[model samples]
Each structure stands twice: as C-alpha cells, then as structure tokens.
Target chain A: MTPVPDPSEEWRRLDRRTVLVTAAVLTGVAGGAGLPTVLGLAGAMPLWRAVTWVLAGAALLVGGGAAADYVRWRRTRYRVGAERAELRTGLLLVKRRSLARERIRSVDLTAHPLLRVLGLVKVRIGTGENAGGESTLELDPVTKAEGERLRRELLDRVRPDAPDSPHDGALAVLDPGWIRYAPASFVAPLLGGAAAGAVMQVSEWFGAQGEVIEWIGDRFQDTSVLGMIVVLVLLALLAGTVGALGLWVEMWWNYRLEREPGGTLRVRRGLFTARSISIEERRLRGVELVEPLGVRMCRAARVDAVATGLVKDDEDKHADHKTLLPPAPRDLADRVAAQVLRESEAPTGAPLTAHPRAARTRRLRWALGSALAPVAVLAVLGAALTPVLLYAAAGCALVLVPLAVLLALDAYRNLGHGITGDYLVTRSGTVRRTTVALQRGGVIGWTVKQSSFQRRAGVLTLTATTAAGEGAYDIHDAGEGEGLAFAAEAVPDLLAPFLKPTGVRDAGVETRKTRG
Target chain B: MTGENAIRDEVRLRPPRNAVDERAVTWWRTQLLLTTTVPVVVLGVLGALLQPARFWLLLTAGAVAVAGLAATAFFPAWWFRVHRWEVTEDAVYVRTGAFWQEWRIAPMSRIQTVDTVRGPLEQFFRLSTVTVTTASSKGAIRIEGLDHQLAADLAERLTRITQDTPGDAT
Candidate 1:
C-alpha cells in the first residue's frame, strides 16, 4: 500500500502559459466588439484615428485580462495528497475546495485549440457527488505532461502484483469510415429544420423576410410546384447533411477508448477542443447500447457507460463525455462493450425474452390515439372553416397513421428483458432504442408500479433501481405475474419476501394463460 | 414449486403493524386546518376589502374554506389509520399514499443513511419524521408522525443494521 501523503503541504501554482491563453481570448473578444464600431466609423472619422482607437481598446482589454489572469494563476494552487485533492483560488474572496481521494470518481481533462498550442490542458477532478459545483475541483491550464501525470497518479489503483495486464490496451480507436453514419443520424433532419427556422428568424430580425421569400420564389419560378417543393426539400437535406457532418467531426474526431495500466477507462475525443474522461472500472455498473432510429436503420449504434458517481450537471461542459463509443457498426459497438466489461461476449447481444402481445396492444392503442388527435382537430376545423383545412386533415391522416403504427410495432418488437451471467439486459424504445446491460449486483432496490389501467390490462412496470446510470432500468408493460417472477429471479429474495402468496399464484396462472 | 409456494405464503404473512403515536392524528388535524383556513381566510378578507362588489365571492370562498377545513380535520384520522411502517431484519416496509396506495420496500443493505427530522410543527407536537435514504433514484422514503424517541431509535437501529451488513459500498 502506498503511504498517505501529507495534506497540510505547500500549494503549487498552475503553468504561466495560462496568462497568454487568457490574453488571447480577451483580445479576440475585444476585436469582435470593436469591429462594428470601426466599420461604422470608416467614412465618418479619420482612418488612422479609428484604427488607433480600436487597437488601443483591444490592447487595454488584453493587458488588463492578462494582468488579472497572472494574479489568478499565481493564487490558484492545487495539491493532491494521499487522502484528498485540494484546490484554492481567487484573489479577493479566496475560495478553497478539497475532494477526498477515496471519493474521487472522475478526473476529466480538456484542452481547446489555444490551450493545446501552448501544451496546456484544464483538469477537473470530481468526487462524483451529485451536489453541483461543490463536488468538483478545477485546475485550469496545467502543462500536458503534468496533466498526464496527475491523471495517472490520481487514478492509479492497480494491484501491486500485476504491473501490466493483457487488458491494458486500446479497446477502441477512431475509424474514419464511421463518419458516414454522421449524416445518417436523425439529428440531420432535426438540424435541417433548425437551419430553416434560423433562416426565417434571422430574416425576420433583419426585416428582409419579404426579400428572401421573393428571391426563393424567383429562383424556383420556372419549375413546377411539385418539382419546386422537391428541390427545396433536397436542398434542405443537403444543408442538414453538411451540418451533421461538421457537428460529428467536431464532437468525435480522434475518439479513442483505452484501458490504462490501472483499472481506469479513459475516453479521449474532440477535434478543436479535446477531452479526456477517466472512469474507474470498479465504479462502472454496465454499458448501454443506444440505437437511434436513423442510426439503427444504418446498422449502427452508440455506447454509453452506466457507471456510479458519473453525475451529469447542468454546467458540466463535457456533458456528452458519457458516450464511450461513437455511432459505429452495431457489431463493433457490441465488441467494445464486452471489452469495457472485461467479458468475452457482450451481454447486449444475448437473446431476450419477448414481452406478451398485450404490451403490443397497449402501445398500438396509445400510438393510434396520439396520432389521431391532430387529425381529429384538423377534421373539426375543416368542417367548420375552409375546404383547404380539409386537405390538411387528409394530409395529416395519410402521413401520421401509418408512421404511428410502424413505430408502435417497432416498439413492441424491441420490448424485451433477459439475464446473461452477471448482467441483466432490458431493451425498450422506438425512436431511441436502448439496450442496457446492467450489473445485477448494482441493483439495490425494486419498485413495482401497477396503475388501475395497468391492473385491468394485467400488466405492470417493474424497475430495478440502482445507484449507477439512469438510476433505474424499467421493464415496461410486462405481464404482472411474469414481471414479478422475473424480478424475484433477478435479485432473488429482495422482491420474493414482499409479494403476497395469492398474488404470486394468481400472477403465475395469469402468466401461463397469456403465454399459452 | 412447493418451496416457492411456502416462501410465498411466508411473504403473504402481514408485516408487523407499527402505527404512529395517537397524538399524531390531533397534530396533523390541527396543522392541516391551520394551513388551509389561514390562507383562505386571508384571501376572503382581501377579496371583500379590495372589491366590495365581489362580496359574494368572499362568501363563496368562506364556504369552500369551511368545506376544506372539515375535510382536512377528517382526513388526518383516516390517513393515520392507513399510514404504517415496519422495519424487518432485512428490509424497511413503508405503506403510504391515500387514494393510490404505495408499498415501498427498501432492503437494509442498500440503506445509505437514516435521519430523523423534526419540523417546527412536529417539534411542537413532540413528534419526528424518519427518512431512510437508499441508493435508488426514486429518492428517500420518509415515515412521518412518529414519537421523537421512537424515530431516534428507528434511525439508530437502521444505521446499525446498515453498518453490520457487508457489500454496502454505496
């Protein structure tokens, strides 16, 4: 065992290069602010005078920011002792924070292009407590080497006997070919819609909506109405594809998932702003394979770590850092999941027991009801108002009914739960199908919910509540008996002792009747 | 199958009935009436004073407040009858909710912390509420209307059980 280092020790300051980075950011901001003023003064004022004014403003801002940053850097000190990692900063107020070493669950590193150029990275050491800013200690602008060392030393929990293991290797690396799935994501169409909305908003803001609409109309004047609509849609799709590709590149460029000498799993990704998220293996509860509709159709899925102490905060910059694997071939995703769990086979790929047809009926009814609401509203409007409204009603019915039915059927098909060795797998959803292979041991409690409607349908929602991941994995619309039985079997005595005898027997009979 | 049936029968055996102190009903009734009536009375006065033309509104509000006060006074006795909790060697069973009855079972091993809280009203009534926090995201399970001494005892017992049970890393 390593000796516990002294806590009451001298605090070390961050690298001086932080001042340069701070000054550069302030200069950029000043330039952006001064641009409009300079442009407005182009003809009104003397060119040299205007230019000098802008230059002076930029210099003053940068100079003041750099001086402040220098003082901040000087005052900001961090120390990683055996028991705790402490950070103290602020020139006037003097704020101090210390995270117990045992409670330290994650040490994430981030470096933007500017910081990267200067070989500096920002390190955030978190205790994994869900309590806002109080749980994290940030050390901004540390040297690259120092960052790497801190990551290793802070996360070093390897067994002394085994200095290196075969598992200590790059589990997954960025595949350029995976970029094709970027445009295939559902985000593409969403981005396209957002772009169109943005165009309208900007034009409205500038009072150029009429001019923009006229320009579009003139461009498509020669085409037939149908052809014009098709062309517009295709153009929107093209723009969407480009936007999705750029977003994908920015978020996932150079993505690498690797296992260190210790039991830490590190995910390094991003292009302009690189991020390194470290998760201890012991804290990892499981992995979730996410297949959004578009990506699923493309035979691709994303992987996420379902680990304890990886609390998502509103202010957390690396909110999406939970993504362990980028959208890739489902086969590759499965393999990476298995590798992360240190298992020979991925639990997600295991065959799951399908839910009863009653579940399907429920989903179908819900889908039809939801889809018909708009149609019903439109039909009422059409009857009361113009015939043009009737056409819209017809259009809505024609598009929504079939789509809703398909989604409902797909959701029914996806509803399944199974246990494979140490993990219990539960699959659900239509738009964003998720198969979570949660560790059975991780589940601390069970909640069985049966509403009056559910009781009439002889179905119940059983949730395995754990401390990690989403905190609960639910098996929705399962036959009450089957769900109870499964829950009892999954965790053994936990749920068994709570169920009434007659209730269990009746549920068993019901289960048999439904299955038969 | 027979062993399973036996276990089921054992499960069906009603959990130990530990009802809250009898004074809790009086406390709850008083608190409920005070909370509901004070707000309504103020609103009624404000309505009559601010808008004399809507004096009928003030009468209507008073009537509704009376009805609400009556319901609040009566509901506490009914709630006191239904709201019960039992702490077994291995689990804590709390049965709550009025119209939609909910029975929550939290395993002793999963318990992270057990706390006894006394609000101003509860303190005045010499009562405390026990909160058993588990690792589950559904949040803590609270058992209100307990004698202060009983609440302390329960909290201590739960804490001791949790400490004794291994594999409670959470």
Candidate 2:
C-alpha cells in the first residue's frame, strides 16, 4: 500500500468487528445445536421451560464467545517490519513470535459468510515451513482491503532476471461445465451414505426413530425386500448427487488460477466463504494429476501443486489446499499442470515406463487375498452353521471375485515411472490413481525397500524422498535394475555411492556414459 | 531359483562402510529383555496371585518366557550385523532392518539438523545414537550404537559441514 515514508515500526490491532463475527458464528452454532437440546429436554420438562432454558443457553454461548474474542482482539498486536513480521498475543501466558520478512512465503486471505458481510478477512502469513504454529501469524479478522494489501506487500518480490511470462496471468478460470464431474467423484456416494446416516441420526434425536422406520416400512410394504432395497439405494444416490452438486458450487464457484508478476501462483475460489491461497513459484517442486476412479472413467482429473510448506492443518486435513484446478478434462488438467510448473508440456503426461510383470502379479495376489479373506470366513461360518449361510457365501464370492480381479488389473496398468526434462514422474493406484511429477532437483534422499517377498518376486520399492507434497513418492514393485538406473538418472550422483555395478557393466563405464 | 538369482544380480546395494559399536548388541539385548520380561513377569505374578488354580495361565506364561528368551538370544546380533552407517564427502549412506532391509542415501547438502540421543540402556553401555535429519520427513538417518564421544564428534562435524553448503536445506 500506502508507500508513505518511514514510520514502519507501528503496531496494529485486529479489526474490532472480530467480536461481532464471533458472536454471529456462535449464534449459528447455538441455534443448530439448541434445537436438538430443546427437543431432548422437552421429554424431561415442560415444553415452555425447555424452550426458555435453550434460549438462555444460546444467549450465554453467544455472550461468552463474543467476550472471549473481545479479550483476544485486545491482546493481539502485529507489525510488518522491514526485516521481520512479528505478532504478540496470549492473555495469561504471553507469547511473541516473529518470521524474517524475506522468509514469509505466503499471505492468504479467507473470509466466511459472516466476515464477508462485515467486509473483513482472516489473514494468515506463513513462512511455508512445516514448523507448526511457530512459522505462521494468523490475524483472525482484518479489513478486507488491509488483508489484500498485506498479501500484496508480503508476497512482493524482485522479479527474476529472465521472466517466464508466456503462461503468466489468469491461467484458468472456472468453467461451469466442469460441474458435471462433481457427481463422478467418490464424494457422491460418501455424501449419499452421510445423508442417510444424518436422517437416521436426526430422527433419533427427535425420538421419532420408530416412527421413521415404521413410515419407511409402510411405504415399502407392498414391494419385495430386494425391490425396497434397490429403491432406497436409488433415493440415497439421488440425494447424494444433489448434495455433491451443491458442494461443488459452494467450493469452486469463483475458481480462478492466476500467476502474478512476482512468480506467485494464486488460487482464488469459494462462493459464500471466499478463500485466496497463494503459493510462491520458487517453493513449488512439481505437480500431481489426481484421478479418482469415477472421475478417470469420465476422462477428468484434478491438478494439485506439489510444493514445500503447503500442508493442511489437522482441522482441515481433508481440504485440498494445494488444488489449482477442480476436476476438469484430462487435457485441461495437463495444460494447467504444465503452466503451473512453467514447462511447455506436463511431465505427468509423459510416456511412462511400465513396471515389470511381477508388479501385476503382486497386485493380483493382494486383491485376491483380501477379497477371499472375508469369503473364507463366511464359508467357514456357513459350513459350521447353516445351508442358507453357505448360499450367501457363494453369492458373495460370485460378486466380489471378478470385481477384485478387474481392480487388480487396472492397478497393474496404472503402475509407471518416467523422467521428463527436470521432473521425475511416477503413477500408481486403481481407485484413486495419482501421477506425480516431482522436480528431480527437489529430491533430497532415496529409500530402497526390499521385503523378503518382494525380493523373491524380483521387484523392490524405490521412494524419492523430498520436502514437498507427501515427503516421499514411491515407485512400487519396480525391477531392481530399472529402479536403480532410474534413481541414478533422476538425481545423478545422489544414489551413486550406494549402488554396486553389475558384472557386465563396469562402474567406470557406467559413470563415463551417464556423466556424458 | 535361476530367475531369482538373475534378478539379484541385476542391481545390488553395497553395504555401508562401517558397522555399529560391538556393545550395541548387548545394549539391544538388555532393552529387548526389559520389554519382554516386564509383561511376562507381571502376567505370571498376577495369575499366580489371582488364579493359582488355573494351570493353563502358568503354562501360557512359561510359553511366553521361552519365546522371549529365544528372541533375546538371537535377534540383537542379527540386527547388529544388518545395521550399518557410512558418511562420505557427498552424502550419508545407511543400511538398516533385519527381515525387511532398507538402504538410504541423503546428500550432505540436504541435512537440516544433526542430533545425538542417548537412552538409559544406551548410556549404561556407553553408546549414543547420531540422527541426521533432512528436510524430507522420511529422510532422518539414524546411526545407532556409536561410542558416546564418537557420536558427539560426528554430530558436530556434520553441523559444521552442512552449515557451509545449503539452500535452506530444501
């Protein structure tokens, strides 16, 4: 902002509207929870008395939350100094934390509906170091413009000498057509199952569990049991599809991926609760192409940044903070991934070297072993108990065996590893296939694992350990020679000291050729 | 068997240059003994006091004791033979594990921190464990059962070496 002279040593308090935001959030929480409390209490006391108690509790909850946040607002003070960004807070046990200004990698702005209404956003300044809370300063609620200004100032950097600007600026904006992929994700069935569970849970809370069950039973009374089950599953699926569509809209309505002037890739999205996430280009190690089973069948994939210090907090572990694009067409995902990494073509889309036959055999064995375990147990119980149980076990085998085999084959087909330019790529998994293109320079270490069975199978797992993304990406069940050669090729001399030369290839010859 | 032999011949990870201190075997034995004895002894005493008439309880305790004794007799030496560590001018190489082997290599430039840990049993045997941590979460190389003085010197040397060559250790 205001590029006024000197006077940068000033401290600033959080926006006073933080208290109001807290109060509103608490009211919503109390309202949702209080209705159930009143219903439960009504059974033990007069309805009017229960209502009065609930109202009193809600008032107390809101008042207490607002008062605590007010104290917090009073205690917190932050300053963006020339060399360091420091924060001082805590009422009883005072704590002061600071990050060297140059080390601050990201300045994110998030505003839920309440904060949006109040024109305030929560600002999180991070060093992109995974040292927990010590490396981050969170301002609960600051003016929206102040948040934006802080983000710009903190992330502003001197442009690199040779700016690669071809793929810069508004890399990909939201395509409303992408919404079709929402129902194809695994989230749909999960949401459907969750919806069914919630219905039962809510009805139970209202002490209408029996009535709800009776009502369902009465509706299906004329239908056969199999027909009823099919109809109910269909209804749950319908509910799930609608829920998934709504969730997709809420999360990705205004999705935009932009590359700013200073090499920062920004993802701005969300409808009611807007989030602006920034990832410094220098911190990015690579990109991952994620294809959940259903999405892959639809020829769609999601792109996630493989970068240092993009870890999600424990509370939001399920949130994909690194996602640059929602599920889109495969080629679009690849293009966005390529642009994200500033490469002409995506490394993840490179032709990968398939793993040896042993890897397929391994997957087949595992799939069959897992699928047969339950069948064996059922068969044993059936043999010991009843003929009816035996028939059920047979039916189970008939359904599970082919499905498991298909998945095993699919997983086998997905196994691949390759190198494209500066990135080393690996792909695996059946249900949730992921192709990770990791910058070879970012690989810090290598771990070679050989279980007794794996050794017997003539395969081993090679893990490229890096500080980015998942910390380690595995090339599973690779041929021993192929894996070692790939490792040596990927990082030159990192794995050289530990590898022994084969008889036919002299170590010196190998070195001379490889170095050349 | 011929195919297995051919696969084994394809690529091999040379064992690291140095073996851990000889006392590591005894230290590991003492540690494993303590872990196994405590539970077995507790079970035996509780069973004798509360269910003395239940002969099966005593038999079960006896069986556990035999198994523990056999493991204490052999496992430590087996593990010691497989556990090795070597630090070169470029990187740190380590080979660990007994049944399932792991070979790790982390370049000197990637090391973030160097630490020395001494457990009570390790201290009793005058041994220390030197841990070299890299930015990667999975890249912590542990060189266990070194002479206490040697471990300290190693950690100090690593710290000095990595301090001069680094790009934020990432």
Candidate 3:
C-alpha cells in the first residue's frame, strides 16, 4: 500500500498544547533573561543588591528549566521509521530504542483539559514484551488528528487498507448518548466532589450560626444532632441536583463518534483540545454491552467494546482511553450489534461466532447467582442475635431484597450465548443491556468452567477470550463438545480487512475447557 | 464429559492474563509471619541458653518455631498445589482458588506474551514455569511443574500466536 498522507494532517497543527508549553517556556526565559538589564536601567536598590535576587531567580528558572527540557525532550518525540518505531528520551541521560513495527501491539492515546488547551495529546504504543511485550513509546503534543494519522501510517506499513470500513456501509449508524459512560463518569465524580465540599460548608455554616443560637438558646433549645443531620440530608439532595445539572451542561460538548467511510469508528471529544480516535470494526475484541441494573428496568443499555488500542489523540491528557461504540437507542443495540461483533461483512460468509442467548446458557447465570443464596443466608442468620442485631438484620434484609432481585433479573436477561456467524457475541447487563461481539479470528482463546454442582448438572460455562481483559467477549453454556465446536466452527482463517495490529490471531482456536 | 476428564484438563486460568505476574501474593501472610517470628525464635533460643532461670523460655522458642515452620512449609506447598494451568488449543486455562474455586482462561490468540521462569524452588524440583500475559488486564497466568523444554516450547508457541494475531487497529 503506497502510503497516503492523512487527510486530517492540516488540523494537527491546530492544537494548543504545542503552543502553550512552548510559549510558557519562551515566556519564562524572556522574563528571566530580560530582567537584569531592565532592573539595571531603573537603578533600583544597589545594583549589586538587585543582582543577587535577580541572579538567584534567573538561575532557579533556567536551572529548573534544564531538567524540564530534558523531561519534555524525552517524552515528546517518537519516530516510527520504515521497519521500526524508535523511542528516544531522557532529560539528563538520553536513551533511544526501537521495536520492530510488526512486533507492535496496541497504541493508546489520552487527552485532558490542559492538553486540550494546548491543542496536543499523548500517544502510547504497547508492544507486548521486551522487543515484543510492553515496549512503550509516548508522543506528547501531537496534533488532534496526528494519533489517527500515525495509526494509519502504521497500518499502511503493516497491512493493506481495512476492508470493512464504515464507508462500506457494513456498520449501522449509532446514536451516542453522552449519558451512557459520561453520566457515571461525569455525574458521579461531580456529586462526590460536591458532597465533600458540602460537608465543609455545612460545618462552617453551622459554626457561624452557633453564635446566633447562643443568644436564642433562652427561647429555643440548640439544634440537636438529629436536626443537623436532617438539614445535612436536605443539603445533600440539593447538592446532588445541582451537581447533576452541572454535569449535564458539561455533557453538551463535542462527544461524538463518526463511523468513517472505511468501516471504522472515529470518536472525537473534549471541549477544547478535541480528541479523535479510530476503531476499526475488525479490531472489536469483545463487547461489554452493559445494561446497568438501573438502566435494565428502563430498557436501556450502553454497549462498550473491548477495543484493541487506545485513542492517541487524547493521551497528552487522558493517556489511557478506550475507543468505543457510543451508546445508542436501546432498539438500535440489535441493529448495530452484528457489525460491532464482526458478523456483518458485505462479502458472503456465515457469521462465525456466537451470541450469549444460546440454548444452554439461558439458565447458566441463574444457576450461578442462585448459588450465592446460601452465603447470603448465612450472613443474614449470623446478624440476628440481639435487639440491635435484629434491627441490623432487618436493615440488611431490606438491602438484600433489591440486591437479589436485581442480580436474578440481570442474570435471567443476560442468559444466552451462541454463534452469530463468524462473530461471537454475548449480550448482558442490568442497566445498559449490551450485545458484545468479537470476530472468530479476533478470539485469543476459550475458557470453560464448571462448578461442582454445574458438573453434576452436566453444564460448563465457556468464555471466548479476546485481547480485552476482564470483559471476556462471549460466555456460553453447552454440551461438553460445544467448546471445541466453537473453535472449529467459527475462528477465521483469513485476517479481517484491517485487523487490529496485535489482536488478530493467525492460528487455530485453542479450546481450554475444564471444571475448576 | 466426566468430571475426571475435566480434572485432567482443568481450565486453571482465564484466557490471556490481564496483568503480568498475575498470581496473588496469597503466601504473604505466611511469609510475613515466618520472617518476623524466625529471628525472635533465634533470640529466644540464645536468651534461654544465656539465662536458664526461666525454663519456660525454651517453650516460647518452640512455639515460634512450630508456627514459622508450619507456615513456611505449608505455605509454599499450598501455593504450588492450588495454582495450576493448562494451555489448551484455544485458551490458556487456570484454576487458582484454594477454597471458593474460580477458573480463568486467556486465549492463545489473546495472549500478549508467554514467559518461562525457573524459580529457585522449581529448579531444585526439576520443574519449570510458563507465565502468560495478555492485553486485557494486568493479571497473568503462570503454570508451574512443567518440564523445562515444555515450558520453553509453550512460551515460544504463545509468542508466535500473539505476534501473528491480526487486529489491525494497533
């Protein structure tokens, strides 16, 4: 593939991080170097006396600068040459090393407010170990579009262009709700910060009111702890409301993801130093289609993919960001689910993998959740000893009522895993009911587990592994041979067009099924 | 289909360990107790010999020695016995829980790296270990008691898979 320079390159220089950091350094130097002459002309304090503080401050600034420049020089530049990506760095003791690009695994990018202001971001490329694993390179202050551009360059040098890019119209258009990941991210953090602030304010306010109470004590008793608690609770409700509203306002910024013409997802966000990341459909490892308990009842779900690389555009700030499918209308979960799971290719072929709602797994989650009942019962029993214990037991029961119901319901909803063509997908979650997907070729391995009783029931839970950890993409329950069947039946022999740099396997699936 | 077959093919670890060095430091309590108590036992033994007026001093050293020895011997044994792994064709399986019983596996395709390690104890026992790391979480799966050649071969095989796996997004 003859390399095509990125169409987005012009926008790269538009970042402010490069400008700000450079400007800040220049400004500090100008002020420090120019100060002596300026003070000398004014003849302030004895020139000798003035020279001491001015010289001292100047030395501190420039001396401090030598270290700063070295650190910046170290983390700032990374060049991926023809065969290798060499990362050279260090402020004092400079170092340089290059990993074969073919050995490169995943590249991560994160952009924060400061980086956004500077119009720059950070990018990290992880090549598993030594010359291969965990060889990391960070590029700071790259333009907003540069990360994707670098990824594109790396992709071109490594493989042919991705086959199923969004331009092919193979992927369904998704509507991203800032509410999905953002609510928990933005709202929870906001409320938590506000709550701490509120506590401090309440204490100060009450302390100030104490003087008034001292005079009014003859007419009315001092506000009791109960009264103070009640007031604090009311304040908490007020704070939560205000915090939520503020977060909603912050949510209005550009947090959109466009499905590019090349069957790839391009997600861009951040109000100032806008960050954009590209996720190829082929790199979809596993989907964490979360239907959080609250969202489940509301019939909504947030589908997040266990994508291969981090968005390099934002890493100057958010160094570790997962490029994902934004939340869409719940009804659309099924619509776009197949493409996200690698089941839909315009070319003719059976979808290789499976979905969670497969036959045997329908009851798998229920069995596992019900198994927790004994432990919960034991704890409940252990709490019922004295009068205070009885009240505590009652309180715990109230909490368990919702916990058990939610778990059981969520389990029942999540119960299913079966082939969805060459793409293996599992759909589960209470709030954001999800449909997770992964290409057979994208599968790293398979896991089978059976509890003692499950062994008795003749059932084993199977999870299809992908590069994405914790969120194994698919879990199925089937007859013993079903595991091997998944590997033999689905895993792709040919790599998908634009397979993830390090995620796709060139070998047969390994079925690691067993009872623990 | 039988439990015996499952035992032989026990899916001991989850596919692709999320972290490198994924094993929990379960022996930390035992290690902590032994390191702290052993020196105290030595001090007590010396003190008892120097000042024999307190006959019970010898009993104190015996008690510490008993706890330290029990922890040291049983701890490493339990750690090794409970932690087991099997890299089947599809996934690297691990079964690591001592009591509650949890099984995990990482796919060969998902494995980021496979490492072979021969710890001081394993070398003495003529055994080797294979450590598997994945792109997922920081957790890793280490399978001990394999022959040295087998461990090296498995690591080579795993690295090959990781290298060839083709998610183009990297």
Tens-digit lDDT track of model 2 for A405-428: 999999999999988999999999
DockQ of each: 0.27, 0.51, 0.16
Ranking by DockQ: 2, 1, 3
Over B1-170, each residue of candidate 2 has an lDDT whose tens digit, in order, gives 22323444555788999999999999888888888888788778877787655577677788888888899998899988999999998999989987798988999999999999999888999999999999987788899999999999999999999999948988
| Candidate whose DockQ is highest | 2
Model 1 root-mean-square deviation:
5.0
Taking the true A–B contacts (Cα pairs closer than 8 Å), what share appears in each candidate?
0.27, 0.63, 0.16
**Which regions of candidate 1 deviate over 4 angstroms?**
A1-10, A36-60, A160-166, A197-210, A222-233, A311-319, A385-391, A503-516, B1-82, B98-101, B120-127, B163-168
Candidate 1 backbone collisions, by pair? none
Model 1 has a DockQ score of 0.27
Q: What is the CAPRI rating of model 2's predicted complex?
A: medium
- Model 1 C-alpha lDDT per residue in residues B1-170, reported as the tens digit of each score: 42223222222323336887887898888788887777787777778687765677687778878887888867887778767888888888776655444556678889988889999989999999999887766646789889999899889989998989887445
B28-137, model 3: which lDDT tens digit per residue? 34444758586766768676677764456666666777777677656555545556655556566666543334455455555666778886655654557788876544
Over A412-471, each residue of candidate 3 has an lDDT whose tens digit, in order, gives 555444455455555544434455555555665444556655555444566665554343
| Interface RMSD after interface superposition, each candidate | 6.2, 5.4, 13.0
**Native-interface RMSD of candidate 3:** 13.0
